[model samples]
Target: MRKVLLPTIIFIATILLVIRLFYLQVIDDTLKLKSDNNAIKINYDYPERGYIYDRNGNLLVANQPSYDIMVIPKDVKEIDTSEFCTLLKITKEDFLKKIAKAKVYSPRLPSVFLSQLNKKEYAAFQEIERKFAGFYIQKRSLRDYQVPCGANVFGFITQVNDKIISKNKYYNSGDLIGRQGVEESYEEILRGIKGVKYIQKDKYNREIGSYKEGRFDTIAVQGKDINLTLDAELQKYGEELMINKRGGIVAIEPKTGEILALVTAPSYDPAILVGRQRSKNYTMLYHDSIAKPLYDRGLLAQYPPGSPFKILTGLVALQVKAIDENTSIICNHGFSFAPGRFMRCHCHGGVIQLHRGIYESCNTFFSTSYMRTLDKFSDPSVGVDVWSKHLKTFGLGEFMGYDLPTGRKGNIPTSKTYNKVYKGWRWSSKTIVSNAIGQGEVLMTPMQLANMMATVANRGFYFTPHIVRKIKGQIIDKKFTTKHKTTINRRYFETMISGLFDVYNFGTAHGLNVDGIDICGKTGTAENFTKVDGKRVQLKDHSIFVAFAPKDNPKIAIAILVENGGFGATIAGPIASLMIEKYIKHKITRKDLETRILAKDLQPEYNRFISKPIRDTLINTKVTIKEKAVVTIKDTSGIKKRTALKP
Candidate 1:
């Protein structure tokens, strides 16, 4: 019995020892594994990007599945160098360099070599994929721009760079990010949540099975879809009209302030920047300096509004109570500001009413009217400040706050600006006389000018101009959709509108008038300078026209700028009229006028055109007599990229 008890005690001691050993080996194993995993394994998921569409439900930008062949440098082993290179269609030296780059980037992270492979290439790689242990395909999506209407406005997407990642944690290496335009503005909405999936692997590093049957996996949510305000047809036509021309056109609904069509010349297919050939095409576009097709001239260009600016001057005079509809001023073909200085005007006028003055674009009347408005102010500086404020209400000297990301805050000088330049507030009435006639330091974007015309057409209010009408299923926010009021009085717009109608019917833009449509318009010829070898040279004048059709309940308010166009009445005026006529009547009527206008080739380009010094004492200077050319109608088949240079 004693011997049995001794044996039992030894067995109990043995059991106790085994239990302690189990605690150390089994329980601590998890802690050690955790530390090991912390050193090696890191996981990431891809996020889905947003979709884009036009107002009509036509897909503009979408996504297409793409694949990248990635490699884990350290994990790669037993790779048949020659065979692998042959399959990948790469040389041995190239493969080695790529592997070296992968090591430099990160060994644990997958490095990409062949991206956006075709279906055939992908299939061939998939068949032999198992042989390559550390190599795999990373599924991704690339932008597929179906239509390239708004290339600059829509922008593009590219892999996030280090700078972007440093700025925002939402992005990391290999993340897709918005590069410009709407994509940047609405990044929050367009960038969707990321999805994740995990699978257990064996000692050979082969994926065994799902960890928990996808229970812990998160599904990707699609990004919010965007709907634009662009009328696809009109945008297409507008682009066609501006073909070959170096200028831009902006048209908006006067009442809603919704941009109908915005066209910039030297445009290209936006789709060219997407898919397999993306990098190649992008490099080409980036280096093309002659066309600069990527530049968004519509929103970025800050040009003198020319005659289109007269609309604002008319509104300001009436709003300031400095002029009435019947207010009359005389013009002797020019405005005499001082003894030797004179502001030139186009032919025709002797004591004309305020309405007729605007119709004829009489510089003399505007100079006097502008002086009267300034004189009405209590102080000269105060008057300039007040005048600038009024202009701001019309969306000048500021951004239109359009949905588009690109825009310029055009210059509208205040008294402070003038004082900074010329020093002190001691300047007299003639100091800013040019502002009265839409000249001097004032500059406006085509978008701003278009909206201003819309404000005049709507009588008092305009909506914040936007290219997008909705995003996904949600309508564009109320802040931009709401109507915005200008500083001009409600009743003051009619006089301006009536005068514009007369301008189209009998004034400078008379060639633009249609038989049935009461087209309202005003023309401007702005003198600009060209410098050659540090010498100022006289260049051709810019032809500009602002117009709206039907005159009442206007549908389109448009601003047309033809780079270096000789005369507003001849070049810009006819082009604008053709667009209006095409939109309203669906055809061109005045073929003779259209043919003649198209035939008159504008000699110089915008960058080359210059303004000459006006003869201080010269009179009846034979004015380089321009003949009124006629347009000839033809089938609109090849009308795309028609070049009509407006000076």
Candidate 2:
């Protein structure tokens, strides 16, 4: 019986071993994958990125053929290193360093050695690529900008870093990723899936045939094309108007909340970030500390809203029934909230109503209204919180959740904010009276200001402003389409709208109104200040303006801010009017205004903050521009310095 049991156990063990072998060979493919890895070389086929078109179907960005030099460290064979380096226009040290980096990334995987070669360079490299055993040329596509504008909107692609590779499994060494703007926001949809082919290799590293007859191969899928809400003509025109200027301009469609033109001054050509010279050009643009061309002022720069803020003050007051359209406040050149403190006004001495208050930009009237609204509640903290809530309804103080990757949630101070500032001391509306005039801690981005204007146009609601109108074969996120209602009642906006309309009829912005267009606008001049060697010093004021055209059924809402441009009427107003006219009328009737703005150079005003030596060095440095209207600056010493001023 013991002998029979031993023989039976041995037979069972033999049967189990046979079953395991069958499973590994027929059912499970893990061992097959390992075997294939040893004898197969995988190559990726990158598909062309989808084209980008403006709302009017004008091509904004298209793909151009490019080549990347790829390396496989384990497959490298000794060759003429000098000839290879010369052919690729790289030094021997650089080649060695790239090979070392590729090895560190993965000795078996392909890594980009050099990327984005032009046609001429590609042709030259193709001739000598066969001489290098481990190196190969991979075809890819880079952005070919149809126009030179919208660098801030279009963004650029760059090689993924190690951190990115570690975070995202889809990316490998030398893969491209979007850096900012729309590209970064919609990277997944824009960068299509990469196809792969596995080629079998012999022990001598010679190509034998396709691995497993290409059963595991995949075909690349092209990226989905997108249509942006921008108007290419308007974007080009706005960029031209912003020549020699350093600021931001944002225009939104009131009804749709689609961003029309987002212009940032000192912007570079998008093409500069596409080719082999991208790193050098990007470094220059990045380190130009004075201009900060890489900074998206439209979505990032926060500043005091100035007079445009008065509109919100009036709206909040009206919503709380603290003030009405008929409510009048007298201006004796200013209002005295405290014994020795006074808030000054620019309006003529007289009794002013809400309508007149907006157009005249009456400091005394708005301050009094702000005080009355806050004083209505017994506790100033509760009142300030309520006021803050009202502002938040307008999408102020918080990130607007726009479809961009970069933005700032402009400050909207609450009761808690003031509590910290006052440090437990008793305070009232009088203590924060400067806030009544859009000064103090109230800050907003140009995009926020434009959205505020759009809210006013919608009479208490707004759609989240977005760049892409539609994605091919897909619906946009519902967040962009959802209506965001402000705290103010819809009826209250009419009074403010009437006041804004009068701004064009007889207020500060009257002089810059477009012919036959009922433009409702508010002008603002935020006092600029900065710390110069640890002392707060006053700088030239920043000009600001916000407006919506056609008044009733508004088509466009826009906000413009010009740093150190003096009064809002002087620079910001005219620029907004021109932009509005260009967009609505599709032609410029104010040739004189256009000519003056085109010729005006404010570099000297900017230079006061930056050292003269630095300014001199930057002068006469040529920056590439497209769509004509390029200026050959002899000296740009006076433009406002971004580093010299603080919000």
Candidate 3:
């Protein structure tokens, strides 16, 4: 029985091996063609990248014809090197380096010799193409920006680096990929599949005809067109308003959570990164470290939210039942949490209810409410955590999961966050009452604040803010469509919304409103400080504002921050009102506001902080240095990181 079993096993193994060999030889030719690399010349058909359209179907990005000189390093027959170098506008040394690098990449496969050539250059090179053996011009499609703004929104495409090539077998040395913003986040949907074709080559290393009668070839699929939520006209207007400013503006559709416009000041035109000058222009933009034109302040910059944060504080207080709409507190021009110490306020002293507290930006009302909230619980730790839990539900203290790639989840302090800072020191609501007025450890990006406004506009629930409105022939991510409800009751928002509406009527932002629009808004001024020559100096306040229009049925919700722009009503409020008007009415009725804002440039204000020359301040503070000096002082602009101190 053992001898029979062994013989049967051997017989089965032989039969399986014979079937596999037959299938490999007769049926599948894909692996066979790939193995025969020496006889086949492979070419990739790069598809046209997807077109980007605004939500209203306006074209934001389209394709333009361009060319790249591709090289197969081993197939070269030397020609007039000097003439080739002159036509390509590259030095002889650069030619040698490029050829050597191409050879290092692969002698048989194609590599990019010179990329992003314009039509004139392509035509001139094509005239003398027959003279060079290994090089050929490959026709390509490059990004053509239809508008002048949104450089950060539709990020530029560039060649893949070595790291990408090593990880992705689908890409070769010369392939292009998206690097930031919507382009990076939706790369798979925007960059369609590149087709492959294998042609039989002769002994001379010249392509003859299709291998295997083109059975293994695949057709290039043009990238799927996408509709971004941005309104092109609104985006352009926002950029114009922010021309000489140093901050950002973010607006979202309250009902859908679609990002309408995201503007970061000191940005460059997207077209500059399209042709032969891309590398040079990009280097210039990247090196301008002070202005950071390439930096998307709307998505990346995190700053203490200032008075606008009080809106959330009011909501959290209501949810915790620490205060009601009718609850009133008397203000003596400030909040006195401890003896001989107080946090100052700019509001007129009087009896302040929740409505007047928000409109006047009162510090006393919120501080007392915050302390009462913590005292409600047996331990302040449990109380603060509950407060933090409510704020997190509003998309604060975390990334909002927006479609754009670059961002920071602004810090939201929990009890543990303070515990780590205090190191077991005794603490309570009075210890951190500055948080009540939004001047403490509460940091948020412009995007998050905009989302918070959108949440309020929606009454209780909000969809995750997203840049993509639609993708051609495919559904967008499900997460964007899902609703996220807050921990607070829906009815509580009406109480808060009424207070914000009066902010435009009788409060800090009373003078900054558009006629014929019922705008509910909050004005903010976040305290800003920086170090200059080893001394911490207070800079002008950062102006901030958050608002939604038509109060009852909202459309656009916006947040704007103007760094070092002083009070919120001066800069951020006007910009937000103008934006709301532009989006809703489609034209400007307040030419006075438009003219005044357009005429104002905050560059000189920014220059005062960042443009000072280095010198020994101990001797002559304003003198520029021309000679060697002892104890050279450097003026730097940055926040000194620390927990918010109690008054």
Candidate 4:
């Protein structure tokens, strides 16, 4: 019985020993496999970014190969720390701090020490690359800007923030993303699908072969090309024309609503945001107080239309049946409601026809007409509300749904808004007489104003303004092709257009008329400024002009604003006229006009150009501190106080 019990105990012990061996070798195999992976895995692959292009098959943005020096705390080998720090031009303290941070970020994963290294830098490192184990270079792509000045339109790509990553699971840390404009709005379309390549690594962190013989690898697909309606020459010309000006110009085709040219003065070259020197250059340009070049004034600036508002009021009157084509309104220089006070007109004709009223921009005619339209309704506010609604349909006080991201919803006071502001139960035309002349609370973007002129040119209907004519190999959205209908009758626009034609022939915009090409236009000098103290400071007026050319079949319609440019007829009108002539004739015949416009020096407020001297002056002012404290600087006698440091 004793011999049998002893044998049973020994058998149980043998079974326990075998179970322990199985647990250690098989059950814990995952941990061993992970440990093996860490030993051989060194390099990481960076997915390529998408490409961008213009409507005419021109490459706008593309990717160029870049390299980043990275460090993996766990995988680093024995090396001369001093020599490595000197080669990288980094301080020993900075190197240690980076390594410590990298450990916290998972010692297996690499962290970037220097990003977007140039060819020279990469070549320097390539000479001694194999010596470093964990501190290897990772290949990537950086965005290259071609047509460099359209920063606001094309926007920029920046590192994805924590907020961005949290918002979208697709984005990872260190990923570049579109920050503004078309880049932001069409991110999905522009950002193509990323591809992955599986690589097999041997021990000691050396790549052995492609995993699965490249079966699991994916070839990177290129991004779709975007086609814009922008005419490169026209846009550049407009920008040059507005060099010293403080406003914007928006030109659009009346038939297609495709923007031909868009310009906002004080714009930065998009090229400044590309490559390794991007952050430094951006900081310098961004903080520039004078130019304020980064601001996108084209779609974002909201200003009173001034006298251009009268054109819409004329259409509104005609739409409401309160005025006819030959309807005459007597103007004794102004419209007077009370005993003495009157809303003044700027030197217009007397007893003018509806067409002549528009041609001469007869303020009294519109004021009386707008008042009559309001008189038709029981509540005066209802009539004004109706007028506001019609204006909204014209793309005023609302977004124009452009291809570019940035846009301001210009203010169009609603009945409810008026009720809240005025605290009144009722309102009348007299209460809102300023709107007749495109003043008071009425405001609109240059693009919106351009579309309004396009609508007038189309005779009561126009296409919605858009920047993209067509994306390469892709169809334009139906919304852009659809026409926007206004309240004004088709017949009314004919007479109004005829009067506008007469304006270029015989009225305010006469100075800018081309003999063969018929141009219809309205000039507006908006009075805006305030006195803070006893001294009467001269606050320059905004020069505004809206026009369409070759009246029979209007090809191009545009709105121009020269902020603080005093007279619209002299400043903004001539610019629009010149653009029309250039677009239609394919050249500017009026050399005299060009010379005068270019040479004419406007006010200080209007002048915001980044002259070469100013740019150089700003760049020279920047102080560069050497990264290495050991590097010595020499100040040579007879040499300008420039400090020369070791590279």
Candidate 5:
């Protein structure tokens, strides 16, 4: 019986082992595929990135062929290193370093050794690539800009860093990623899936045929193309008008909340960030601390919203029942808070109500109204918080959640904010009355100001402003479609709108109005000051203007800011008026205004504000002229890097 039991146990064990072998060989192929890796060479096929078109179907960005030289460290064979370096126009030290980096990344996987080779270089390399084992050419696409504008809107692509590679497993070494702007915001939708092919190789590492007849291979899916809401022609015109200026301009469609044109001065051509020259050109642009061309002032720079803020003050007062349309405040040329601490107004001494006060930009009137709104509550903190809530509903004092990658939470001083500054509830409505005139801790981005005007046009509601209108075969995110109602009731906006309309007809901006357009606008002149050698020094004022055209059913809402440009009417008003006319009329009838703007270069005014050493250095280096030439030529060849491949 013992002998029979031992034999039966052995038989059962043998049957179990046979079943396991059959299951592994037939059903589970994962281990088998790993074992077969030694005889299979994998190749990646990158798909063309999606194209970008303006709202009018004008192509803004398209793909151009680019080739990269990739290397597998484990497959490398000894060859003439000098000859290879000379062919690639790289030094032996660089070649060695790249090879070391590739080995560290992965001994068997491919890494980019030399990237962005031009057509001439590609032809030269193709003739001799067979001599270099372990290296192959991989095809990819780089952006080919159709226009020289919108550098801040259409950001560039760059190779992924170690941080990105670690965070996203989908990306490998030497992969390109969007850096900023629309490209960065929609990276996933723009960068298509990479297809992989497994080639069977012999024991000698020679390619023989496809592995398993390509059963495991994938087909690359092309990226979905996107249409931006921007008007390319208007954008170009705005950029042209803003030349030699330092500020930001944002235009939004009032009905849809689509950004029509976003222009930032001192911007470079988008092409400057493309190809192998990107790093060098980026360094040059980045080092220019004065201009800061990389900085998107439209979405990033926060400044005092100036008189455009007075409009909000009026609205908040009306919403809180602190003021009515017929409510009148007298201006003795200023509102005297204390014996010497008076908030001055440029409007001639007179009694004024809401509409005339707005058109005249009466500082006294707005300040008195602001005081009433804040003084309504016994505790100034409660009043300040209430006022802040009303302002935030207009998309001020916070990140507006626009589609851009960068923005500032412009300050809307709450009771809590002042508590930190004043250390208690020691402040009152009169103590912080400068806020009534858009001074004192209140700040806003140009985009936010434009959106505020859009909200006014929409009568207390706005869709989140976005650059993208649609993606081919896919709907845009629902956030852009949702309407955000402001804290003020819709009925209150009518009074504010009427006041704004009077700004064009009888206010400071009356002379700058377009002929056929019924424009509603506010002009602002913010007092500028800076520290020079640790002492406050007064500089030229910052000009600001915000407006919407065809007031009844507004089509375009825009905000323009010009640093050190004097009164709002001097520069920003004309620019805003021209921009509105360009978008609505599709042609500029004010050629005289256009010529004056084009002929004027405000570098001298900017120079006066800069420190002597930096100003002298800039002059000695001729950096401004070089930068201007860089924009005009759009030639990246002067940049020190491998030439990019052409399509």
Candidate 6:
């Protein structure tokens, strides 16, 4: 019995070993992967990035071949450093630093030693390709801008950093990443999946096909193309008009909430930030505090909405039943919420209704309406909150959730905001009356201002503003398609629209009317102030304008802000008119306005603003800071000085 048991155990053990060997060799394939790891070399095949096109199918950005010098530190062999440095047009110190960085990143993994090599540089390096043991050339696709404009819209590509590598497992050391604009907003969709291959080395040192006979290899899937809502012609025209001016212009389609034209003045050619020159050009743009070409003023720069904010004030008043179309507030050149606290108005003294108030931009009428809105409520805090909530439906007071990466949540004050400011004091609507005419604590981006007009044009609802119009073979996010209705009723917009229409016909922007287009607009002169040597001083007013054309079923809604450009009717108004005419008619009948804008150079104003020397503030003496820090700063008599404790 013992001998029979021993024979049976041996036979069972032999059968189990055979079954396991068969599973590992054929059915499992796990050991095959591990077996190839030591003898196989892996390589990646990167695909071409998706092309960028405008709504009209005009190509905006395409791809160009780029080369990166990659190194695997572990595979490096001692060679003549002098010859290698000369071949790559790099100094010895640069080479050493790059190699050290690569080693620190990973000794076995590949890292970018020198990247974005030009054609000339690539040709020079090809001669010494054989001498370099660890290094190899990697081909990549870099952005080649079809047009010179829209740097802010197209954005740019750059290499991944250590921070990014640690967060995203898919990205290695040498991979490129998108930075801003459409490039950044849709990076995952635009950057297609990269394919990889593995080649095995036989014991005889001969190269063989990949594991599983190339079945494991994948074909690169090209990135999906996208269409932007931007009208190339309109974008180009707006940018040309903004030459020498420091400002932001945002235009949107009222019906769809599609961004038509986004212009940031003092911009650079997108081509400059491509290829090998990207780093140097970016550094220059970053340091230029005056123009700030890299800054997206349309989305980032926040300023007081000025008179255009009266539109929201009027809408909220009507929604809360504080004021009606027939609501009249008499103006005696200005308004007085409290004695000695006079709110000045340019309107002549008379019975001012909502229509006359908007066109004339009468401070008294709107301030009264604003006060009535809060005064109707039991608590000023609750009333102010209600008023603020009404405005937010117009896409103000928060990030509008646009497709772009960078933006500011333009300030919209509520009960909480004032609660912090006044603490427990019993504050009245009069204390915050300055908010009625778009001044006070209210701030908005040019994009937000444009979106407000879009909401008005849509008759109290707005689709979230977006740059992407279509993604190939896929629908856009439902949020962009979803209509957001304002707290105000639809009936209120017509009355507001009528007042805005009259702004072109009989008011401040009368001179800015296009011949055929029934343009509706509001001109604004926001009081610009900043701190100089710790003293707040007023600079020349920032010119602001908001408009939507056709008066009914409006096609375009636009807002613009020109820093230190005085009256809105002068600079911002004309630019708005030109943009509207150019977009609707496809030609500029008002060539005179275009010529004046083209010839006008605000560089002198910019120079003077930038030329102000900023120095340390000393006690009992006058000190000067830069213009943005103080603008037209002359008075420092009451300014505070920072005094450090004596050592």
* Candidate 3, residue 367: how far the Cα is off, in Å: 1.1
Clashes of each: 25, 8, 0, 2, 0, 1
True-structure lDDT of candidate 1:
0.73
Worst 10 residues of 4 by lDDT: 625-634
User: Where is the poorest 10-residue window by lDDT in model 2?
Assistant: 626-635
Candidate 1, residues 1-647, lDDT tens digits: the string is: 99899999999999999998898787655444444442333344565678887767887788887777888887899978898889878899998898898788777666676677767888889999888867888777778777647766678887776687779876655677777778888877887877756565567665666544554557777788887777666676666655556567888877777777788765666766666677766665565343456667788877877767767777787788888888988889998998899888874969877787877788888888788888898877887887888889888898778887788989998888878877844786697788776678999877887887788888888899988778766767787768778888888888788888888777777656777888888787777666787889767777777888778889888887766776777677787787777767777897876676655544235323222321111122221111111011121344321111122
Reference-based TM-score of each model = 0.83, 0.93, 0.93, 0.83, 0.92, 0.89
Candidate 6 to truth, TM: 0.89
User: Where is model 1 more than 4 Å wrong at Cα?
Assistant: 1-50, 81-86, 89-97, 212-215, 585-647
Model 3 lDDT per residue over 336-442, tens place: 88888889989998999999999999989888988888788999999999999999999888888888888999988999988988885999899889888777888
Instruction: List where candidate 6 sits over 4 angstroms from the true fold.
Output: 1-38, 202-206, 609-647
> Can you list the residue pairs that collide in candidate 2?
603-637, 603-638, 603-639, 604-638, 605-638, 606-638, 606-639, 606-640
In the range 4-49, model 4's lDDT, one tens digit per residue, is 9999999999999999889978775545544555543423355555
Q: What are the RMSDs of all candidates, in order?
A: 11.9, 5.1, 6.2, 9.9, 5.8, 7.5
Question: Is 2 or 3 the stronger prediction by lDDT?
Answer: 2
Residue 302, model 2: lDDT of 92
Instruction: Name every residue pair that clashes in candidate 4.
Output: 55-227, 148-270
- lDDT, candidates in the order shown: 0.73, 0.87, 0.86, 0.75, 0.87, 0.85
